[model samples]
Target: MHDALLSALSTVNDPELHRDLVSLGMIERAELLSGVAHVKVNLTTPACPLKGRIEADVRAAVLEVPGVQDVQVTFGATVRQAAQPALPGVKHVVLIGSGKGGVGKSSVAVNLAASLARDGARVGLLDADVYGPSVAHMMGQGAARVTANEQRKMQPIEAHGLRFLSMANLSPAGQALVWRGPMLHSAIQQFIKDAAWGELDYLIVDLPPGTGDVQLSLTQTVQVTGAVIVTTPQDVALIDAARAIDMFRKASVPVLGIVENMSYFVAPDTGHTYDLFGRGGSRKLGEQYPLLGEVPLNVEVRQDADQGIPAVLAHPETAAAQALIQVARNLAGQVSVRALSQSLADLPDQLTVV
Candidate 1:
């Protein structure tokens, strides 16, 4: 009976991973008693967007086994650590980058980290935009008092369910950072190593606009999981976004996907949706990379962000907030898929565990 149940489940493939559950080691337990089957399906991440569909597939597949009159299914998740050569205490380092400014890259970074933390993962937010750091302000950290532990490691500020750090907080009031190569390099290295980031599942870095030294510095500093490009649905923005994608490719960093921000607007009075920044600009890029989501322009999101509250937490039911949350989940799924693929790459070719 156990063999029969395992055989049935081996035929069930993960929707996103494209492999059987048994082979992937997602079936934590499978038991048979009194002609009823009991099973548990452990997913890659708690924020899996297709969890409902996977659960349904499990039920359908197990029900097909003869003599199993009933089946009970439960779900749990464990985010896979990035294929090593990864950073110490950090499972994934995701960069939220943009081609030019004014596209809300920092906003996406903050919300993405918050969304993941809300889903029960230890998350960190690193503002690597040395020239223009806004994470301290966006997360409502006005007088950020960064302290050092006994080992003299800088401790991250806690905000919005994330361990946050930013150059803005470390610098004095109303002063510009005129530091060049050596100074910039030292700062990034300290942020990556000297900081006391303990066992984070995701470290979302908000990179400054364009493909510049900071981007190169980050790639050289650590093994990055991937990058997510944020752009508006306009020709100018899309052109720069394409350049950003090319830069990641050149750096040997995976381009996770593209997110079209300020994609459209809707009137509160008449319920009319208008394409404020032109339409379908991301379609061309979508051919090469996944279009994670199209986030609408909302005055409330702007107001909430200014007030140091992420939209995903401030207004969960709002369209813009929901879109961002969905984008976050999609990003998590992509990270898990990439990690699993890399791990499989190092294993024997003939994986017959299932």
Candidate 2:
């Protein structure tokens, strides 16, 4: 009966990774308890958006086995760590950037990180924008102070169930950080190296605009998982986005995808939609990258940001919040595909049929 269950489970594949769970080693254990089938499954990431589909498919597959009166399915997740040794206990590091400011890049980063953390992933947010650090304020920790742990490493501030570190917390309010290139580089390096970031599935770095010193220093310091570019539908923003994409390409870092922010707006009273930025700006990228999502303009998002609550958590049913969740899911899917692709490539000469 156990062997039959294995054979049936082999036909069920991960909807996003497009690989059989059994072959991918996602099935931790499978057995028969009298007339019931008990199965344990491990997901690649806690932020997997398709777990429901996977579960339903798994149950359907197990029922095909004879002598199984009922099926009991249980799930757990273990994120795969990269080969990089930069952040000791971090599994993946994702940089959220844009070509210019005022495009809601920070909001996107905050909400995405929050969404992933809500999905049970151990998440950390690092505000790498020294000159204009707003992650602290957006996270409702503007008055919070940074402290050192017993090991003398800077500790991350806990807020809304997410661990975050920011220069805004490290420095005083209304203080201007006039840092030169070398200073900026050193600060970035310390943020990546000197912080006491415990075990985490994803560390999201909200980077400043443009392709400058901080970006260079970060690439030199560690092996990043990839980068997500945020832009509006405006021509100028798209042009700058082109340069940013080229910069990442020159540095040999994969450009995961692009995010279109403020794509459109709908009047709450009249329920009429308006293309506030423009139309089809992402389509101009010429199929070079995936359009992660189009986040609509909503007054509620701004209100939520000020209140230090991410849209995905504060207003999950809103259009803006749903769009942000989609972006997080898409980003997670891409990371899983890349991580599992290497594992698939390194498969042994002989197959191990469980």
Candidate 3:
């Protein structure tokens, strides 16, 4: 009966959450004795909007099993803790960063994380852009605080099958975060060190634009697997992007690849593509560094961003999504290593200043 009850939980899915309660780690414990069932589950948020539905499904699943006389269901909320020992299984920690703002780094990070999650990889995204942490908004999660589990470990908010941590989760809605350098860096460090990111295949950190103190601090502290530079295909953007790459190179963090955002715009009425942001800047920069892929400007991608649904998940068949997925797959292939030894091996033989 216990085994059957557990199996039934595998069938109960969280509709809005879009993950099986079992896979979401919602079912903490289950016991059956003398045809009676006892179960405990953890929820992602306090006042979960789906509490009633989730409870109903749990009861139904356990009762449907044969020889179940009485079923006991328990629910609890997750909280944030100070810290936990690191999980050694996290393979890659990719930083999706850029030198200038408005290059769509967060969009690339969010979509890429979703794409990687779809490919059966355990992915996590840390919104390191303290001033503009848009990952929570992009992922459709309202302002909420993270929780800590029984082991006193910080529990990350789950959305689209990927675990996430961001300053937006901590700040109140509609309020501007006016924090200083030391405080911002400390908060970023806490989000990285304190959160319980278990066995992640890739942990993508969306960094703030330019080579600021936060960027320097992260590269110094965390073992950044590599960094993907996001830039628009324009002369000015390329100049700043090159400076960003130089910063990473000086720090000895290998440039995994470069992704050009808003590379081109395609008109809806006619099958014509316009070079809105100029042409070949990204390609020229790619020639300077390791080029990954370029994502064109698409209405569908913009629409998905507006609705908090990543284009990779909302419209996986689109060309833009495909391009993002390819970049993600490429990033996933990189091996994880510490120190500057293996990472700096791929630096351009001759550094070019833009």
Candidate 4:
């Protein structure tokens, strides 16, 4: 009976990871008592959305065994950490920022990471928005707990083919973060120096709105590759976005490009286009820096974000997703070009023969 129960449980798999629970070390123990089987399952995170589904699958599978009149399923979580060496193998770190709040910076960062992953790049997302961390909920790992490895480094939570770390994952939900400048600086340092982010082709950082201590601390702490400023195609947003560009310039970090989000909206019923926020704002900003791309205002983007899935993955055929993909490609191309230029410049000039 126990063998049958184990086999039955083996058939259940984690929906996201697509691996059987038994092999992943999720099934802790199982026993039969008084015609009722008691089982314990361990999860990767507390905030896993598929908990109910996993529980149902386990219960139903166990009941199929002979002599099992009832089944008792319990769940526990043990979050594991990855190794964090001093020299993390991340090729490029891109910071995504906005001048003001509610400009969809986090959404852009998430979709950019997803798009890069889709293009076969190993990506990592760092939610640097301490005051308003949203990556945990956006990536569907809000209830997930982070654990430390033997080296005592916090492991990034994995989701949507990207490894992510966020303040929301560390603290309790709805808790106010009243941290001062020094505390915020220390936290940012810890996130960069102590977190186990392994090897990644790109590390996308979602900065908190405005040029605050967190942004300053990050620029001072790490050698950022560049920054992408996100803004709506409105006067207020563009004004703030200009400040963001200036902030990156002062920090000596290159402004990779400007992404004009919510550029326009198209009526689904009438198929009519509307410049809801006005147009050509990003193009004007592009005169100072490259314009990565403009993303149209779409309801599906909001729906996907709320559902904890990136639009590119949730609705690949949508215009918003394709626009994001083009941005990713352009960003990747820029990074490559800059790397090559730097490499060439670093080469020692050959001695001229007289």
Per-candidate TM-score against the hidden true structure: 0.95, 0.95, 0.70, 0.73
Residue-level lDDT tens digits of model 4 in 63-179: 988999999999875432222211367767789999999889999999999998876677899999999999988898999988898899999999998899999989999999999
Sorted by TM-score (best first), the order is 1, 2, 4, 3
Worst 10 residues of 4 by lDDT: 78-87
What lDDT would each prediction earn against the true structure?
Answer: 0.88, 0.88, 0.76, 0.83
Looking at model 1, residue 111 earns an lDDT score of 84
Candidate 3, 1-354: lDDT as tens digits: 545676888788765445566655567888888877988877643324456778888899888888888888888654211022123556566788898999889999999889878866678989898888889989888666888878776789999989998878887876788888888778877877777888776788999999897888887667766789999998899899989999999998878778988888778789698999986688787676656677888889888987889999999888788888777755543322122223235445332221
lDDT of 2 at 74: 90
For model 4, name the residue pairs that clash: 47-143, 47-144
Clashing pairs in model 1, backbone N/Cα/C closer than 3 A: none
Q: Ten consecutive residues with minimal summed lDDT in candidate 3? A: 78-87
Candidate 2's residue-wise lDDT over 57-157, tens digit each?
99999998888888899999988776563388888889898888888999999999999998888999999988999999989999999899999888999
Question: Best to worst by lDDT, what's the order?
Answer: 1, 2, 4, 3
Q: Per-residue CA lDDT of candidate 1, range 203-293, in tens?
A: 9999999998889999999999999999999999999999999999999999999999999999989999999889779879999998889
Q: Judged by lDDT relative to the true structure, which candidate is superior, 1 or 3?
A: 1
On the 0 to 100 scale, the lDDT of residue 91 in model 2 is 83
Q: Can you tell me which runs of candidate 1 are displaced by over 4 Å?
A: 33-36, 345-354
Error of 3 at 284 (Å): 1.6
Q: Please estimate how well model 4 matches the true structure, expressed as its whole-model Cα lDDT.
A: 0.83
